[model samples]
Target: MPSISQLRKEEQALHALLFTQAQYKNYIPVKSDSLLQIAEAYYRTSSDSLHKAWTLFYLAQYYRDSDEKEKALSYFQQANIASRNIENNQFKFLLNLHWANLLSDEDAENKGIEKYQTANKYAILLKDTLKQIDLYGQWGWCCLLTGKYDCADSLFNMGLKLSTSSKMTYYNYLLNCLSLTARERKDYKRALELVNRSLSLAKDSTELYPLWNNKGEILLEMNQYDSAHFYLSKDTRDYDPYFKATHYLNWSIYEEKIKNLPKALEY
Candidate 1:
């Protein structure tokens, strides 16, 4: 038999491969089914409780991403029970965070908030500074999306205070989120400034897309029609199939705003 560590490593690699497939393509149906079979093998063979928990979590996530929420929730609950048998706070925190995000998407906001609050407590208990910063980003966005601006501000600023000088991506994520919050509150001037700062810090196209789109939207809100078109046109690269649809939607809206019905129809 392989050493348990070696087995876990193999399982982790398999999970990463499956996760990447799911991210880009929604899923590879055949590959996903094979991975689940492999996960079941791990669950049956592992005597270690933590290893069992880890397999369960990955299976749950795959199911969730594949739109099998009921099955996902069942496995997640099993994972949670198994996780409690291990003494690792980091593991516990991650489980809580994933569960929280799922619940949030299911429209169970109160349950999601409770799970996030528990994850933050676990982060503090473990003294995991990076996890602390990440939770701030996660929870801040949660609050922002739910129309809780004051709560979002407090969480983002707290994360900023704890962030180290070397991590620009962390700061970039926070600024983009904060800019959106400002935009939702109709502080267009503040939103423009914050998003521009975010764009300046971006290290790649992934970071650039959201910020560029936000700037264009801000210009549209400000009645700067030509500037809006200019900035929005800059976001020409196809991000992915799903996001390409979003790009077309944005362009269509922009054309409507400019009263170009023919162009809107073309978009």
Candidate 2:
């Protein structure tokens, strides 16, 4: 039989792997089924409430990423219940933040906003500026999707004000959100400028695709069909469903503009 120390070490290692993958958008090296089994085993064996809560949280994240929404919600509820006895404010904040994300994806934007507000209280308590910035960005995106352009503008600007050169990624993300808000408000020039600034901060081609797609959308709205096509085409190979959908929608519009009705319909 494994010693308690050995079991704890294994659980900690599994937690580190899941946490890194969840936080950084990195590809998981282990197979999902294998990871799930290990996490479940840890959850079953751990005597610590905090460890159980952490395991459940990661299990929720895995299910969420896999689009098993019902399972994810169940795990999140379990995690929340398990965490009630703990005093970890940072963990509480992260839990609420991710729960908000899931809610938002489920079209419960108002509920998500409430969760974000709850998370923000913890963020304030912890004095985690980076986490606060991330919350603002995510909250602003929800507002943008709900057509609350002014609200989004306010949230993104607030985040931008707190960001600096050291946090270029957050700064760039805010710029992108602000650009979308500008576009929604019919300020095409401002939208273009903000997205261009985001593009300037992009570190690699993977980051560039979405920026190019946004630029293409702005150009499409400006009636610059050729420029829109040039930029939009750059994202054709991107496999993300959201990006692909946006590309198809914009491409349809471009085709329509060029009087290719069949092509537009095909897109």
**Best by the TM-score measure:** 1
Q: Which ranges of candidate 1 are over 4 A from the true structure?
A: 1-31, 41-46, 164-168
32-149 per-residue lDDT for model 2 (tens digits): 6455556667566666777678777877887887789989888988889999999999889989999998998888878888889999999999988898899999888888888888
| Predictions in order: lDDT | 0.79, 0.83
Tens digits of lDDT, candidate 1, 45-106: 66677767776777777788788998888888898988876998887898889888888778
Give TM per candidate.
Answer: 0.83, 0.82
**Residue 170, model 2: Cα distance from true site in angstroms:** 1.6
Q: Pick the candidate with the highest lDDT.
A: 2
TM-score of predicted structure 2: 0.82
After superposing candidate 2 on the true structure, give the runs of residues whose Cα lies further than 4 Å from its correct spot.
Answer: 1-25, 29-34, 41-45, 165-167
lDDT of 1 at 16: 47
User: Could you give me the TM-score of model 1 versus the true structure?
Assistant: 0.83
